[model samples]
Target: MEEIKMNTIYDNEKFFNKYSQMTRSQKGLAGAGEWHTLQKLLPDFTDKTVLDLGCGYGWHCLYAAEHGAKAVTGVDLSEKMLAVAKEKTAGYPVNYLQADIATLTFPVATFDVVLSSLAIHYVADFKRLILNIKQYLKTDGILVFSVEHPAFTAEGSQDFYYDEKGNILHYPLDNYFNEGIREANFLGEKVTKYHRTLTTYLNTLLKNDFTLLNVVEPTPATELLALPEMKEELRRPMMLIIKAKNNL
Candidate 1:
């Protein structure tokens, strides 16, 4: 199959907008991993300042503040999404800023930790985004994030799904290595998301002085294991838990 840009499916503003709202499920799923990674990565976050990128409704950021984080701020390009996050994290020090990750400007070494969850996939210019985070993080600070599995995005990766009689079926997506913007409406507002392959993401982080530490995958909680569909997903790499540090 040939590669296709992210424009095909993400072209619909309505559907895309719905995806940006709380209707999106991946945020919660990825957020669960964030919770796990947090305890493992920063066990002593009580006095640390944090910046959450693409923080849809600030679930993780709020969790940090409730438990420990000295202060937390979230940034996203979609105001509607940020609005929801703002409401969800109301009465807390969690601040929300609406801006594209590409041109986001912040003070130098301003945060103790920078986190994102399945949010970086929407960035087309991954290199510049990572570099931009440098100014936001103090030395020895960690950038923790999660990403969709590349195997699912690879060409012909749908073989794992078979019909009742063993006939394989799939989403029929081409351009598995897509790198482009998906235009859509998020929360009734026009917005676009950029897509880049996993390799490009890794290379960009490495180029930006990020040192990889831990890469993890989520394990279903006891509740999810009872569900057949989720149980099957455990056999493959569905998501990634990446812990990286910017030496500078």
Candidate 2:
């Protein structure tokens, strides 16, 4: 219920080091497990202005620029992440800003498309954030974002219950209706995340004059199932992607 300060945990040396090594961090959008589905939900970027929230490493920013976006802005709170984003973004010419997405503002109708990848759950005030986003977006502009699924966040621990043999027994789901701060351990460090139900996520958008276009819960593709880790994804949905249009 209460908003917390913007989380800059990604700037921590150990966490940043670990995050920098992730497949998505190094190889960009192609390396993300949900990219296949998320990409499908994205509106064509051709000559449109784009704003990417929590744009760690600027993967989506570069993708938009390369795909014909006229202007692209990437915002994040972590300096370490922005450093890497700036370095890797050589010729793409993305405007990367080290600012908290929750507090950052843009002029009305500033962007044609707003994108956030795997970062919304960390926000403490979901409703307020989206309202701000709606104001920044042009009429009928698109908003596409991915977050840790509510089912995955419902358990608080954000991990699976395992059997004695170390096989995942189930991804436990409890306190699903209790939406608030969730202190999760990631990369050997504690990080803050917020939990919100699917109902809240959808209804909030609908109430804010945004029309839902698509809601995708991505899973590994058939070919990816051959990998040992990909099979575990079938047991529970880990990510949620939503695409909506701002209707003035």
Candidate 3:
């Protein structure tokens, strides 16, 4: 399949403005739940060279530096996002770069750990991206990432059928086998995402010689349960986290 160039909705001026106003943890990653679970799967960063693909706002990059990573590089497609990340990571060891994760290149075996958070789904050819990722990691280096769950993305709409009484009847699962670009509403604007099956996600890593370490479909934490909106997450997974080792 031909790769789609990433022009993420995050690059939209209004969306970036709104997104920039939110706290890092609130937007996603850190605090608890799936984000916290993904963090637990990471290897120690002490003195390790780390690279973050699609590193929005450089939260993970900053975290790696704070945890004693010798060097940290953050790559993102959005100039606005990279600017924010650069400003936020000032005085830290993190280096922010503006580049498309799908097409970015790096020296072979340059990093001990590669991380991406809530990204990668925007790329049309994830298998190819995984292959590129393998070339950038050292032997036994780790690749950790999170993306929208196949089950959730399969529908594109990410909506549940509800009765007139406003109760959810059931979650739809049509066109699950049809993989490609999916358009949906996000923060009152239309956004695009790519859908891939669970098999594709796992098999691609295996085909690229990556050893699968762990997979997680996060459940809401105890504190999150108090929020009504978070209740829907209990019914179905919204995200999938995977950790793999470059065994080359």
lDDT of each: 0.67, 0.86, 0.84
Which ten residues in a row are the worst by lDDT in model 1? 1-10
- Model 1 Cα lDDT, one tens digit per residue, 2-73: 232333323345544556554124556442523444456643568889888878667778877887888998
Candidate structures ordered by lDDT, highest first: 2, 3, 1
- Candidate 3, superposed: residue stretches over 4 Å from native: 1-8, 21-28
- Compute the lDDT of residue 91 as modeled in candidate 1: 84
The residue pairs that clash in candidate 1, if any, are 3-175, 4-175, 13-185, 17-185, 17-186, 57-85
Candidate 2: segments with Cα more than 4 A from true spot: 1-6
Per-model RMSD to reference: 5.6, 2.9, 3.4
User: Residues 1-248, candidate 3, lDDT per residue (tens digit)?
Assistant: 22223485667777777666653435645444566677689899999999999998787898899899999999988888888789878998898888888989899999999999988998889988998988989999999999989999998888889999999988888798999989755555667889999999999999889999999898766776776767778888888999999999
Among these predicted structures, which one has the highest TM-score? 2
Please give, for residues 53-109, the per-residue lDDT of candidate 2 as tens digits. Answer: 999888899889989998999999899888888877777758888887887898999
Judged by lDDT against the true structure, how good is candidate 1?
0.67
**Candidate that beats the other on lDDT, 1 or 2, i.e. the better one:** 2
- Which candidate number would show the highest lDDT if scored against the true structure? 2
What TM value does model 3 have? Answer: 0.92
Q: How do the candidates rank by TM-score, highest first?
A: 2, 3, 1
